[model samples]
Target: MIAAIALAFSFLTATAQAKVLELHRGVGVHEWLNWSPVNEDGTYIWPPYRAEQEWLDSFRKGTVSKGENEFQRIRSMGFDFVRLSVDPGPLVSSEGTKRKEALAILSKAVKRITASGLRVVFDLHGVNQVPATSMKLIYDGADSEGVARYRAMVKEVAGMLVKVGTDKVAIEPYNEPAYYPCDASGTDDWQRIMEATVADIRSVSGDLTIIATGACGGGVKGLLNLKPGFDDPNIYYSFHMYEPHDFTHQRSETKGGFASGMPWPASTSTPEAVRKALEARIDAAGLSRAEKRANLAEADPLIAKYFAENWGEKQLDARFEQALGWAKTNAIPSERLFMGEFGAILMTADGRMGADDADRIRYLTAVRRSAEKAGIPWSIWEYANTYGMSVIVPKENAVPDMNMLGALGLMRQ
Candidate 1:
């Protein structure tokens, strides 16, 4: 009789814990239907060439099928969520037809994804992609026309989800506010903007979950400093993790400021060693000797600082400790604090596997294990694309990059 009573108590305790500790594992699907091509003058090509419209139509139809089929595959692989990155261009456009088309497409995608048993985190990523100079156009005066339009678009989008009648969709008002030191002081303009946006979203649908993030490209420190002021149980804080950026983004195609062949576990390459390689490369490039000397002088300190900092398993775990520490400080549970993005590039721009795939795998494994240990849910940077970190290799017969999937422990079988 005592054994039966103890078993019942244990069962109840486990059920309660499961309810409180549900964590979302997801991938970011980016720049598909949401991207609109623009003309040289920065104007959207409306009634996009019929060929373009046909391509878009085919893509929309294809996305729905992919959501049902391809996404199903991911779900089977143990992921249950999708962080759908969206560009607000068409949704916020002055062109009525384009706006309608954009809304319809997004609604269809969301419905299909949910129907496939995968939850969607609809993110307004386009806001951060706009150039800094033109950002004012999106965040004009306090009660600016731009602000009103943005709120309207958000409300409409939320309403569409509410109509779909599924609690699986969450709305992220903005991605990477890029506003630092958001405080009680009014000088933090972006904080005010975000608060207003959140308030507007609540007014539209109180039942919808809201995901929020902070400035400085939404780094963990930004999340630590965000003072969202009001409290709502459904609101979750998110931050991207790419600590020791030099290691994660070294020799990037877009910003290869550092020397190549920079190994992971930083101890593998000291500053002096890296400097020698940089000098050799500069020499081979046929730069003036004076230019070579100047470049080396500038790169030396950066290389030194990069290698001196965190770059291995212990250091990676310490990075998550900062995030876990922040959650504890705010009285937020680990389940509510998400590591929204983190991944290691696996290839160079020239389509060659990165010089150090083994090390990249080690780094990715470290990040994955750290997030799990800290109970911080995270989504890999992307699912498929030309980007080095994408897990899916794009081709005639697309397939998952087993090396990356294995490193991250996402293997289906």
Candidate 2:
């Protein structure tokens, strides 16, 4: 009876929290088991990852990995939650003993993360892979056998989550679905599959908070375009914010090093200004004369497009306002609207390409403030990564980026 009463009280608390949208400030925790770098030979490539319990035990103990408490460091920096990205590929694709072990790891991860005093946003992140992960399987279409299998997986995961309790964790059923166009032209299959997936979760855990997202790559346009046929108080709407991908994902194409230093708020920069910076960068690079000319020639068009787009705080606000309006139209509370991911790439000494520190921080401040002003809780793109978008320098025994913390409005430790 005591256990049942405690569960009831927790459910009420979770419901109340959703009623007013308890702000969940967090960062994306990736690659721990998220199918990153799917081995071409189908062998595990994630090093620094031993057994799940061993690593999770160390994480909670704060005695391993970074030589300090990592989760504790995140809390010290003022984040209260983590968007734990888990790949569903193995669990759904496995059977019998293998599947049981996979589910055990999932439970252990949630238990340890919560024990560390952090809420978990169980983000079922999927990727398009040959062996078929959640992203590809689910994206194959709403009625596909893959979707059927995934729904069953969702049901099981939801059961595990409920046992963990609703207040400490919420489930986002899918990552950026592939429904493109975000209009009548776009397929409505995602909507059906999403509704069905929610039903599957609800079948077992009715009170567990579910995060529903629009299709079209899960961006503002997608969320704005999504129409959740029904409303549940426990359900919060979610969307990703990385507008002007050129700026945030800059230099992702190649290490050619031409598109590195673009600023936030396109108005703060001009074509000539960026070209001038690139010229200096190229000169400092000491490239052969032909290479220098070739780099500049390649840079001119991208620079022109960046200026033409004219992205800035006003534009960011405009996008948020549209999402806000979508919430209002759908009768969803603004606070219930979740910004699941957003971050600007920072320049690194290695081949990683992105904005310089000053510009990157300025852009992050703009995005973070935009979400805050809209009363939307958000998680930056990631905690650590080789791609220049990390909250910490991705390395052995890594530490936080103080400037990044300040920019995200997180307390710098």
Candidate 3:
């Protein structure tokens, strides 16, 4: 049955090739989980927060219609796929009544997206946000019981997707595994979690592609100490890049919050600066030096081990080379590797909340050029958001820079 499904999907993909179903050339539409498509009291509610239940109602009602329309707009702009932020917590309500309602809303959204001929990657963004000790039935800690629960969650989601016939759905098990620091040795238990999660999912849906995130959303270094037995064909190693977070998260004086008025040195973006900073931090922290050195020593052949990896081209060029070298030494194929997420901030020299559109374009162009030269596929950081390549203003106005998106290969024309 699994073979048959794979064959059918393969055929569908092949036939759809003329439509340019380029997975590597995709862009993410971040904050989909909090986004709503409805207006309240003459104001549009975007980035709907959890506390705003009324706004959520309006948003849910509008999302099926509005979400589809937005996706259509994206597709029209020449994008072939979207990375959706999906939280299964809402779908699995504590109360029976709420569970049904949540499922209905999600089903509607999924149906609309699939019908539009666009592939969707269901990212489990906030599993641990729930009150339960065990989220998605996967154990947060190494305890036996937690592991059991985590497995249960994985099986449940896999079974649900199978029933829905959402063949294009790719599961991102956890959003950012390295958000919390691990041991001093830099030993994160991701391999254990991935192994168990993959086993559960494969049990239910034999061929579901699973995208595995690295620790702290960094690159291949996080996966170095992973136990050897966990590798699987269906697994796609994934990572997220929001480099020199100071740059990406910088905000203006008027925008008062965590990101406001933060200063990031311009030198940090340079290759030498990044290498120095990374080396210094690694040395100071007394973490993972031996493993990193060993990996770099054998870097030539390990490049093919990863299915996809994300990084900022300018900020982490040395790290990228190290990773690629390892893959090459390990005899890993280039096609299996990819740059999953990357983009520059739209900022000016003075660090205000405005678009330095040319710099953004240049950054993307350089990344794309480098990836193409390396024979690696890539997905730009975003679409239809301020941080993304395009900005989705309130109401119907989507201020899209066709040239920028075009440069990133997100927009064909």
Candidate 4:
């Protein structure tokens, strides 16, 4: 009887000690299973143009005999985990055999990451490939049917991943939900959708961790808007960090224009100097005279606002307080909150629009350390792709920017 009692106690103790997921520093793995272009009918372009199989094969077959695969390289770079983003549109668009095959590919992909010795936060990142089955359907007040279909998809995927092992993967149902104005004035539809997302995954496995997010593009304000009344014990709240979006995303296809050479903390340089440099670049863009004038007109105010904000470590700390404060308010521990994604673009050596490498390092270090100081775990924006913010100098190569590594404290300065 004593031996049996001791065995039971051992089981209980191990159960109590086991974490749903243990993460310190992580990085996003994108453009592999995610962001694939879809057909007109919302179906995933078969044999995705992004080369999913070839990418996986690259990880399986190392450059050298008994060489390190990409995932192994990620582990060597000091990342404890990877938030593997997946474009779920294919599952939504396909049926029967096709759906099962798509899911199999995803499961194999997860196994590939673990084989290389990295944990995963399986992220369901949405894209605007098609309104019917895209990121927009769930958040923009779609019909109940659309919402139900999305919930079902999450449940199916979550169930499949947990079978691979609860310890290896967590389900993040959505990314950067765009239910704007995150306040009383905003739509509460996201509230219901977010709840259903958790409920769907919860229905799959009680032990599988769920990554919950707020509405407005997963920022701190968005997290503050959520009211998590969950009965489950395993969950991590997530929010993306790019507070001064204009600065971090500057010169990307989105918000910011072609404003390069800007510094972090804004106070590093005067607005006058920044404006002069920006105007010259705008002129050198070789647009028509009228276009140059228009570009300058568009660039001036954003520059003034960026300088006026004077973003630095202190301001970033204050911004982070909002999330930590929210956690405290909800009686949630700081350790349970996650900086799901944060990164600044790296300007290309060829002068394509991006932030300077030095500036990027400073911003990355400041944000990364601030999150650490707050006792929060963070994952940088991505592992690859020439999307401006990758740690790899060239998207195609396995080279790590030693400076970026130092900035993240992953390598010795």
**lDDT against the true structure, each candidate:** 0.66, 0.77, 0.51, 0.78
What RMSD does each model have against the real structure? Answer: 8.5, 4.8, 12.0, 4.8
Better of 2 and 3 by TM-score: 2
Candidate 3 root-mean-square deviation in Å:
12.0
Q: Can you write out model 1's per-residue Cα lDDT over 1-413, one digit (the tens) per residue? A: 99999976775453333222234688887645445556676665664222323432433434434324666876776777888877676567644667666677677878867777888888877643334313344555446777677778888777777676536888876777655454444355566666787777666656667777776578876776667674366677888877667666655233333344456778766777766766766666676777666666666666778776736777777767877887787787777877778876664633222435776777778888888877778888887666566767644345677887787787833
Off by over 4 Å in 3: 1-22, 35-68, 92-101, 127-140, 144-148, 164-167, 179-184, 225-228, 252-315, 326-332, 348-355, 386-396
How would the candidate models be sorted by TM-score, starting from the highest? 4, 2, 1, 3
Query: What does candidate 2's lDDT look like per residue over 51-123, in tens digits?
Result: 5534344224343555455677677778888998887777676666766677777888788778878888898
Give the lDDT of residue 309 in candidate 3: 31
Considering TM-score, which of the candidate structures 1 and 3 is the better prediction for this target? 1
lDDT per residue as tens, model 4, 1-413: 99999976775454445455878899998878876766685566775435545554443333333454677878998998999989878877766787777788788889989888899999988877665678766754734777777888888898789888888888888889888989999977888888877766755566788889998889999999999876244788998899788778777343334556678878888888877776676666566777656666776777778888888878888889989999888888888899999998787544436677778889999999988987888999887666667766554445677888889999654
Candidate 3 lDDT over 50-164, as tens digits, reads 3323432332433444334666766776666677666545443323455445545655665666677777666665544444421434435544575555456556666655565
**Model 2, residue 293: C-alpha shift (Å):** 3.3
The TM-score measured for candidate 3 stands at 0.64
Please give the TM-score that candidate 2 achieves against the real structure. Answer: 0.87
> Which is the winner by TM-score between candidate 1 and candidate 4?
4
